[model samples]
Target: MDTALIVGYLASICSVTSFIPQVWKIFKTGDTAAISAKMYALTVTGFALWTAFGVMRVEWPIILTNAICFCLSGLILIKKITRRAR
Candidate 1:
């Protein structure tokens, strides 16, 4: 792959991996109290939009990154809702 493609892949990986901190915190501490439902809600919304945009633009890197990000963020959102209910 070219340098530009490599950079795109790295960028995608970093963006998707950005969810690791939140995921680790939730799993290790089992504490979702500090997390805001609204924020995650909005984040998931934005990720969905970005994913759609990536698809429309035929940008595989962006699509892949957003797909992983959406899943990770969705997991946290679900955890937040479940923990809050308990």
Candidate 2:
């Protein structure tokens, strides 16, 4: 593959994996106290929009990357909201 494509893939991988630690920490500790709900809300919305844009443009990398991020951020957002509700 080309250098740009390789870099894109690496960036995607890094982006996707970046959320794992936060998710795992929340899972293990059940603490959403420090996570910003508004930020994650915007993040989830942004990722969702990006995924839709990717779908419209037929770009698998963008679609997959944003979709994964959407789900991950969505999970964190959900946890934050629900924990706050209780």
Candidate 3:
């Protein structure tokens, strides 16, 4: 109901879904040659850390969004690593 809370939700939704396209593209076409392993590794790690922090703080929005982001980034990271091995 507050403006800040509304903004937080909106921002979280946008950030959380931002990885969907990348994950979908990587799996759909099996093309991860251009995806940087370091970048995604850092991203997933960062999201996991943020999710933990959110959980510690008991912030539902942060926990929910970062958890989603962690999973999505983890998916991409996994795909990139596996593709590079082939």
Candidate 4:
């Protein structure tokens, strides 16, 4: 395996896992007042664009990272929105 590819996977794993705590906190406390809707929207948009870039470039690392990132981020966004609504 390529060293860079290995590094990419490791980094992606770290970043993707980073969102778990936030998700848990949001779920446990049900307080999303501090979560910025604009930020989440812009971030998800950026992540989607980057995923597209990865597809065009045939870069698995970028694609994988963004996929996981997007999903986790999306979850957070939804949790925040729903939590606040309730």
Candidate 5:
């Protein structure tokens, strides 16, 4: 692959995993007080749009990266909502 594609992949990897630490912390500590529901909701919406855009353009890196991000953000959103419900 070319340098551009390699860079894209590297960037995607970083973007996708950036949420893992937050997820892990939330999971381990069960603390959603610091996590803003509105922020994550907006983030998930943005990621969904990006994933759709990548799908329309047939871009694997964007699609995969945004899809993973969407899921991660969705997980956080769900946790926040459910905790709020309780």
Candidate 6:
């Protein structure tokens, strides 16, 4: 296998897994007090755009990574928004 491919896969894994701890923390403690909804909203939007761009370009890595990020960030953003409403 190519080193570049290995690096790409590693990066993708890192990017995708980075959200796990935050999600787990939120799930276990239900605390989003310090999380910024606006930041996450932008993050979700950026990931959504990146996913779309990846789809248009037929890039699996970008699509998969950003799609996962989009969903994870969207989850956080939703929690933040809903928490603010309460």
Per TM-score, the best of the predicted structures is 5
The predictions' CA RMSDs to the true structure, in order, are 1.3, 1.1, 1.1, 1.4, 0.7, 1.1
Q: Rank the candidates by lDDT, best first.
A: 5, 2, 1, 6, 3, 4
TM-score ranking from best candidate downward: 5, 6, 3, 2, 1, 4
TM-score of each: 0.89, 0.91, 0.92, 0.87, 0.96, 0.92
lDDT of 6 at 70: 93
Which has the better lDDT: candidate 1, or candidate 6? 1
Which lDDT values do the candidates have, in the order given?
0.90, 0.92, 0.88, 0.85, 0.93, 0.89
lDDT of 2 by residue, 1-86 (tens): 78877776788899999988988899789999999999999999999999999899987778888999999999999999999999
Clashing pairs for model 3 are none
Model 6: residues >4 Å from true position, as ranges? none
Encode model 3's per-residue lDDT on 1-86: one tens digit a residue.
88877887888999978888988898899998888999989989999999999999987778889999999889888888888888
Superposition TM-score, candidate 1 onto the true structure: 0.89
Q: Which stretches of candidate 4 lie over 4 Å from their true place?
A: none
Candidate 4 displacement at residue 15 in angstroms: 0.8
Return the TM-score for candidate 6, rounded to 2 decimals: 0.92
Q: Please report the candidate that would top lDDT against the real structure.
A: 5
Error of 2 at 84 (Å): 0.5
| Model 5 quality (TM-score) | 0.96
Query: For model 5, how does the per-residue alpha-carbon lDDT over 1-86 read when each residue is reduced to its tens digit?
Result: 98887887899999978889999888888889998999999999999999999999998889999999999999999999999999
TM-score of 2: 0.91
The reply for model 3, stretches above 4 Å from the true place, is none
Cα lDDT tens digits, model 4, 1-86, are 99999998898888888888887887788778888988998888888998899999998989988987888788878877777677
